[model samples]
Target: CSSTRKVPSTEGKVAFNFIQINDVYEIAPLEGGKTGGMARVAYISKKLKSENPNSFLVMAGDFLSPSVYNSLKVEGQRVRGKQMVEAMNAAGTDIAIFGNHEFDIAENELQQRINEASFTWVSSNAFHKKGNSQQAFAKTDRPVSEPLPPYFFRDIKSVDGMQVRVGFFGIVLPFNKANYVIYTDPLETAERLYNTIKDSCDLVVAITHQSMEDDIRLAERLPNLALIMGGHEHDMRKQLVGNVWILKAHANARTVFITNVVYDRGSKKIEVMPKLLEVSEKIPSDSLTQVVVDKWNRISSENFASIGFDASAIVLEKGEPLDGRESEVRSRSTNLTRLVVKAMEWAAPEADLAIVNSGSIRVDDILTAPVTQYDFLRTLPFGGGLVEVEMKGALLRRILTSGEENRGIGGFLQYSEKISGNRDKGWDINGLPIQDSVSYRVVLTDFLLTGGEANLNYLTETNPLIT
Candidate 1:
């Protein structure tokens, strides 16, 4: 629905600015010399809005999930979701679309987050289960007690007194259905929303958290989409793909794109001049935003206190790159990944081998200092849970061969035992390579299990250890 519509006046031109950012897991304080925390994002957003009266702030997604604060506190309780809501409210984000990770919790949990959020939660793709048995048949259904309303539609008021109605249609990632169930065809959903709002609104903006390719395709299909802002790939990119302007930011609040657009009333066209502002080092953290982040950190520290441990320099050294050949950290796998595998062994005793993606290990340096809970969180910040799968020894070899062929540094299985061949032989399991038969038990994170960034076809064949 249009909130308000204004007619254009021939007297003067009006300028409007819009800001977009993505993937702030929580209010994290910038450590080391790196800045651009949520506080800094808040600072920049507020400053920009103050400078430009007709400015609106929007975030693409990934506000929840993978967050220690949300997982430990907010999943079932109102407080978990409310913290993000409060943070976003403080940051003054006018609209937010759901990211794939947002569906990590139950639908009810998602609804609680939506309720707590003062800003608009727009999603054109997500829909309620149609049949009575839909939830029953759902692989990841959590039994939601309440359902949320449809996506949001807001009318943007231009400075020139010209009423430009802007519609925000949000779409989360489709493949995220692995851990949790939310189904939709992003392109079709976008078209449906655009068709409904195209005539009513002067501009239709698709605020999606889908992959960059999907966003680009949607823009191509739906010419009415003025802008397609996205996340999930964790890249900072801006381009005019076909008729729509696609904008994205790097993960964890590193950059914010200030996009300016001129809507030509005569031609009824939209032109976007996008500016990607690096939030790190340049902007100061907002104090008010810091309070929220600090609160979350305190709670996170208290809940996951067991994970924290001091590195006395025996186990690993800081800044050392661990590779497959070097035993520096334990060959190939970084000291960080090795520690993660140790954690996996402790968490799951039945698993024979523990595999983790290098991408999941975001920490550039080794663990140092007294080692607070934050340190562990930063190491595996993606919040990816573990998954167990049974595969044949031959199949394992094939997986490794595929990984080798693909030049996968991370997805190649790091085994506890030499399952396929011999680790002493340069970590290559089999001279015969991967076979299709011999069954073996393999453990991996949910991210890789669902075919996240890595191409692991073996995951689809095996049964999941945990849902």
Candidate 2:
């Protein structure tokens, strides 16, 4: 009997592929009646998975926040959080991370959504609060007061006979003591996890909601990290540092990320290819996911259909920059910036000058009516209130200097019509040769007044901006 020896396919090598999508804040249909809804993401995700059986899908945090339906109720009083979980489940997400806004809901509610999630929920820096003696808002999985795990791992089989192991870790910005119960630092936390699991897994991916600098630093330090998918800054691109590939998708589900990596056994090296997928008309919406999204849309409309006027635009579309320092509404500057400035002026009259952080101006489009209170709320939905800070010329200069140095997209300080800086060329803002040491009273949001993330050289003077 001649026995034919077959070549053993069990070489110590494997080929694998996976997809990552970030900053998909809104799963439902946007107000403008455009797509990029959960259904569309679901459609794309299903197609990708079908094409590559070993394919796994992951969301790099910011899946929920600034959403009209999500903000309507707290403590699970309304079921929007549950609905989002349902949509995520239908979309076939294998894992998801957390962004800062996930805390928009209380601890209990956040846990409920996590428990309801069909896939794994992770936030490397997210901490759970222990329940009060009374156990108010307590649930079975989480005590009223306790921190949660920062990472999760899954074993997925590849098309070939190779088994691939993937590890996912998440991290959000640390909440200030006033707001957070237990805060976890992203860098420290990531290091701890990486040290623990570096050898156990074939690949480690970090889901972060941090600034670009923060992500870059992490990639530099973590040599074993395969991918760094993040948000928070809402930058739309893929960057590589060493062997680690860093990616962040635009907010509000406007775009998603698709990353590919090939593992070669001969070289014992893995090559990464990252692509940004703009959520556009080309991709069809998944029918199964659409059913869940439609419900959220109807619910959002019912609750938030009464805040702004129906206008041509809710956000300023991409175009030319506005006049240097003039605060004309007609300027094609950011609509959200214009509105926030208007709101501050209306709310705080005493302050002669008004300014807001570019980051605070989150809404990408202008608000048109049939607009929900939810729309306006989501526009600047961070619970931060309006504040009038006392500042003189010197302080104003310091704030400006700080803003200018900031590398973040929304770090620039937007001023109102009353104040005009060299008001014509972008050069004035981009080219401040020296610090101006003049004193001027300025209006700033509570976020800036507190000197949160960005460093503003300004010192406080007197009046507090209204809440």
**TM accuracy, model 1:** 0.76
Model 2 score (lDDT): 0.62
Which sections of candidate 2 miss by over 4 Å? Answer: 1-13, 29-35, 74-83, 129-148, 175-180, 265-267, 305-336, 346-350, 366-378, 383-390, 407-411, 422-447, 450-453, 456-467
- For 21-74, candidate 2 gives per-residue lDDT tens digits of 666656754545463567877887788767665566777766556454554543
TM-score of 2: 0.76
Q: Give model 2's clash tally.
A: 30
Question: Candidate 2 at 4: error in angstroms?
Answer: 31
**What are the per-residue Cα lDDT tens digits for candidate 1 across 358-382?**
5565443334534445556555655
Candidate 1's C-alpha runs over 4 A off are 1-12, 31-33, 74-82, 130-152, 158-160, 178-182, 306-353, 357-373, 381-390, 401-427, 430-467
C-alpha lDDT of candidate 1 relative to the true structure: 0.62
